[model samples]
Target chain A: MEGNVKLITDDGLRLDGRSSNEMRPIKLQTGVIEKADGSAYIEWGANKVVVAVYVREAYPKHAQNMDRAIVKARYSMAGFSVEERKRPGPDRRTMEISKVISEALSSAIILEKLPRAEVDVFIEVLQADAGTRIASLTASSVAIADAGVPMRDLVVGCTAGKAGGKIVLDLSKDEDNYGEADIPMAILPRTGKVVLLQIDGDVSPEEFDEATSMIVNAMKDISKIQRDALMKTYSIEGGE
Target chain B: MKYLETKEIVYPGDRIEINDLRPRNGIYEDDSQYFSEYFGVIQKSEKFIDIAPFNSPYLPRVNDKVIGKIMDIGPTMWTVDINSPYYSLLHINDTPWHVNAGDLTRYLAAGDFIYARISVSNEIKESWVSMRDTGMRKLEKGQVILVKPPKVPRVIGKGGNMINLIKSETDTKIIVGQNGFIWIDGEPDNVNIAINAIKMVEREAHTVGLTDRMGEYFKKLKGGN
Candidate 1:
């Protein structure tokens, strides 16, 4: 409604020239940081995120859990990651994202095996697009795996939204700003179990279901890319 | 009876296709099915299936020989950094010396290294190391290097062949700890060669015929020298 702007073109293509069911290109790499126990870098659309994982004895002694290891995910964005030159350090938004991410990742990791230990996940967003939370979560999973932490499964995530009365996969910056609804979802690919899900704006039950299904399907492909990236790190050449 | 090809790379949650064999380290069971728990290579044996992870934090276990650096000396015990998530304790009574309780530092001070066996480990990861066993004592003269714990076996090689080769070739006394700490003692030059060879083994532990490759590598080094 702002100056007759249209999120979807008359040809059914989104502003980024993507189809309704098309997602942004994604690239994942593991072992990017030499000093971290495990590390990964991801480039999804215009989002660039790096994740590092460290497993150590739980500190502050009181925080130690006798039954399992605790996950602490810190999601931070650089000052130059956004167009507005955001301030660095943890804000309310980042703290919320970190909390949800920590809970989601805790479900995938085998915490019981590492009693009294803590797995720390540091997610740094060097660049930001629209769906940075999902990108960071995806990269964090790979980093945790790279650290050789036992996990039930790799977590993959995607975003879907309703733009111009049509549900679209992977909203870009512009679409996210003006879209009718946005739904970001993450899941454990092995069991198809939803781990992290958030819905913003208004959508009917039918539209929500459609968006979830779209995100889940896109996540399957993303999951394969994660596996391939990890395999690439340990591929044997000319070895029996 | 083998199932999937041995040494196949796998990821966490990847379903292992095998029958009758039980799961071992790096594997977990879920609803009667077994899945890998680490991003590692699969190893299948006649009776068990295991995963060898590329990298992981060391977990202390009872009876595991470990190389530790003394971190803090208390009245009755010395806390040690054993390259694990959990720090282990060495009680004054567990040491070879019969020293007074208040004089722990007199026997083993902070910053000294020791070779000991884990005497007690609990579900919560609290562990105590002991130096009472034979061949377990303070490591006085050596340079310590750390590698991934999973690669310890490769450094030891089949029946100690690789380690013995390294020891004799470089003329260095070496001790490999299950906790991924290695102690090397000899001429500085020989120690350097031993360190390089051990690092190479850590880097290519997954590759086959590593012993043969290491033999050729040593031959080339000696020929060049």
Candidate 2:
């Protein structure tokens, strides 16, 4: 959407040649770990995430306990997750991303059963592109299931950003660099609860509304992908 | 009407009707009547939240069996480290005891693994425990075979259906802890078969109607029985 790239052209198409609201390709896998309660791997366009979940003893903090169990997340971008290498531990950006992801998951799980128990979700970004947060959240949900933490519905998180002042769903790396605004949301595909919501950059009330609408619509398609990944892992998808 | 008035009472982030400004902006604390789902200190505004002793999931449930290693021995209680969020205390009275009144070390001792059912788990809201169930016992050799911790539930199945089938077909004694460590004892060949079966069920439990196939595999194994 900036130098050497056009958000959209004379033909009304994006630089990636998709429509205004079109998203990139997504590939998902669940239950790759042999030890964690749950684990999953996901690839969205060029971004990749490996998430592991462990449900064990609850946090000892007297204040953190909830009527239901709680979900704690540690999201770290792997050293090689980008064109340029990142450090091993989390950066402030990754920490903020982790908080957003945990909040998204907390809304989807039926945590009351564990009472004081805790579910720890760890996400390591093997590769990253424009939509890493959305991809990480998506993979983490599958890993949470692999961890066997019960939930009423799976949480699906994604984003639709306003690029060059126009709404485009699922930003690519270059597009993110030049995008004017971005909004990432976590949705309960079943109940339509917007569990997590975040926005950055400049947008009017009207632009925000338009972008939100696009993200809500996109959840249905992404939800189907989520279900498909579950089926593939559980052997429920026509495996003998 | 009081609820509406309370809502109208100014908190930093209270949602108000676009024009409902009575100018009651007070510094925010837990002073209002409306209850929050969880607690947090107001960072900047009512809308911005960050709770302290920040919530991390830890709860206990009925029928949950976890893997724990013995850490210490108190005068009358076995201090067990559950390697989880919760700490477990096993009283001498809580076991299938066959020992003298105060000689605590020999009968159960430390560093030994035992399989016990969660007879009491009000852990989220209360402290309660028990080791009084048919499944409760001091685990024995043939060793514990562990799969991924989260895969334990799939291996055990609903109402112990998966575990019972493995026990009956292989003619082995297997105790599966909710923590994911499973103790098995019987013929070596049978032990191997049970372990393989458990892994098979785990790898495919996410499949729709696939447990039926697992049952079929067991039926063939039980043909001569």
**Maximum-DockQ candidate:** 1
- Candidate 2's error at A159, in angstroms? 1.7
Please, what are the lDDT tens digits per residue for candidate 1 over residues A1-240?
A: 465679999999988899999989999999899889899999999999999999989998999999999999999999999999989888999999999999999999999999999999999999999999999999999999999899999999999999888999999988888889999999998888889999988999999999999998897799999999997776645432
Q: Write candidate 1's Cα lDDT for B34-149 as tens digits.
A: 89999888888899889889989999999999999999988898999999888999998898899897988778888999999999999899999999999998999889999889
lDDT (Cα, tens digit) per residue for candidate 2, span A1-240:
246556667887887798988878888887688667668888898888888888765656673566767888888887887887787886899989888888888876656656666778988888888778888888887676545454555678778887766888887776678878888888776457788888888888998898888988888788778767754543323333
User: How high is each candidate's TM-score?
Assistant: 0.94, 0.72
lDDT by residue for model 2 (B1-225), tens? 111100111211222232222212122222332221221122223443322101123344566776555667777777665544566777777778755556778866777777775556553544334566676666657767665544566688878887887888889988776655678889998998898898887655433354577788878776846
> Which lDDT values do the candidates have, in the order given?
0.92, 0.67
Candidate 1 — which residues are off by over 4 angstroms? A1-3, A236-240, B1-6
The most accurate candidate by lDDT is 1
